[model samples]
Target: MRSEPLRFFAWNLGLPLAIALAIFAVFDLTSLDEIISNWLYYPNHEFPFGHNRLFENLTHRWPRIIPDLTGEAAIIGSILSFIWPLMKPGKHDRLLRLLEALRIAPLLRFTARYRRDFLFIVVSFAVITGMIHFFKSHTSIYCPVETTLYGGTMEKKEWFENFSLFHEAGPGRCWPGGHASGGFTMVALYFVARRHQWRHARAILYASTLLGAIYGTTRVLQGWHFMSHTFWAGVIVWISALLTALAFYGWRRLASPAVQAPGSAPPAPEQALSGLG
Candidate 1:
């Protein structure tokens, strides 16, 4: 049997995923999407109408801000962290020299042990974001603002109903909340947390989830997406990160020797060598 920590980790990662799938299975999110979008949306006005009024304008466009901070900015920071050790600071200025030693040097040492894991995390982020964009382009789903519901031209669509991969519904390209994926991609931190200092990792995971949800909400407010789009984006990102972590950890586990019981006979050399042949 696996250890208790492993069991707990699996449960922690799994329960929400199960809930997400169940929600998608049983509920049609169109009506709720309309309700939320209508609440914030003002269809009649120009420049800043509907959900866009609050999220995109009144809040100084936090939808863009949050994703930039959490998504691209975070990824860039991770890359820099991984490479901080390789950076050769010139003896140019007292301020620059002091900053490099006090900040960059410590960060470099701290991140050195996790360099491989950091690379994996970055790759996972790229894959998840790339998948989101691919689906967004191919799914051919329109945004709420573009739909008739919010006074646009195209027909509104329920999740996965009458959907096609190649069909082009209209100019609307708002399926799966690409912006929300930016926030959801932060789940990479959760994968990193699995290795050590799990409490901190849990905190990071929660923070990332919350930020992603909030970012999705902002888009909904702008009538840019249905709630289902954002919800699916989060689920996709979580699942992607989970699979990535499992792939890495499972490979390591399989490569290591299994623990044997006391007085257990060692495997026959021929039997052990059989697979190689």
Candidate 2:
């Protein structure tokens, strides 16, 4: 019973990771990445998304700030929650009072854990951003624009060529599209909301993935990333969110926190484990 979170972690972690790896494998083993990028680029014409005002303003520049700011804001919010327990609306507050009446005490109770929730969010964002950048630093994978397919210097290797971490010195370190990662980082917010069984949780997850896809697609259109790179970024973001949630609350409680024993002093998984030890 106590180990249900471990099971939840395995399923959530395995399923998404397998799907992401499958997506990358499809792109890596086939010419689909080149096929899609080919439609976007020609030796005669440049990758046009770079110059497009709509994409530049909306997707490229503006979105880059969102995850960074969100992480910082959540960190600050969590810290403030320590000083101000009223950061979230109380169960007795106007709108929540109605839920209290309707016996939706779970909502009321979970909302009080805003501090813990915010910690999960910021940590997930950190993991996504940090892991993405770490990969970007170590890998020398070229963007479509840098490859010869689009009138660049480097010979475009077959999509199936060994391209994972070529630590050798080169200008291109564009694996795992960074810009797309910013949008995908919002997935953590969805996980936190879902963990607490909040209303609109599904909407939050859908919106987050859509936003990431939009960001990643814009980069693909611009030749800054292969579809696989963006897919890999999604892998990083989703895994980070899931692992962080599991770390904070464990997989079982994340799946069905309502089943937690009443009067249990430890709300966090590690603390509970520590006491048991």
Model 2 / residue 269 / CA error / Å: 24
Which candidate's TM-score is highest? 2
Error of 1 at 162 (Å): 4.7
What is the number of backbone collisions in each predicted candidate, taken in the order shown? 8, 2
| List of clashing residue pairs for candidate 2 | 5-251, 5-252
Error of 1 at 234 (Å): 1.3
lDDT for each residue of candidate 1 in 69-95, tens digit (9 for 90 to 100): 645544555565544444443533564
lDDT of each: 0.63, 0.71
Per residue, candidate 2 scores C-alpha lDDT tens digits across 1-277 of 7567566766778778788769867887788998888877865487766678987887788877777788888877666544323323544267545555886444324333466777777777778778877777666578888877786888655323434555543455787788888888898887777676777888988888888888999899888888887788888888877878778877655687543355755223222222212
Candidate 2 TM-score, true structure as reference:
0.75
Give the Å error, residue 251, model 1: 9.0
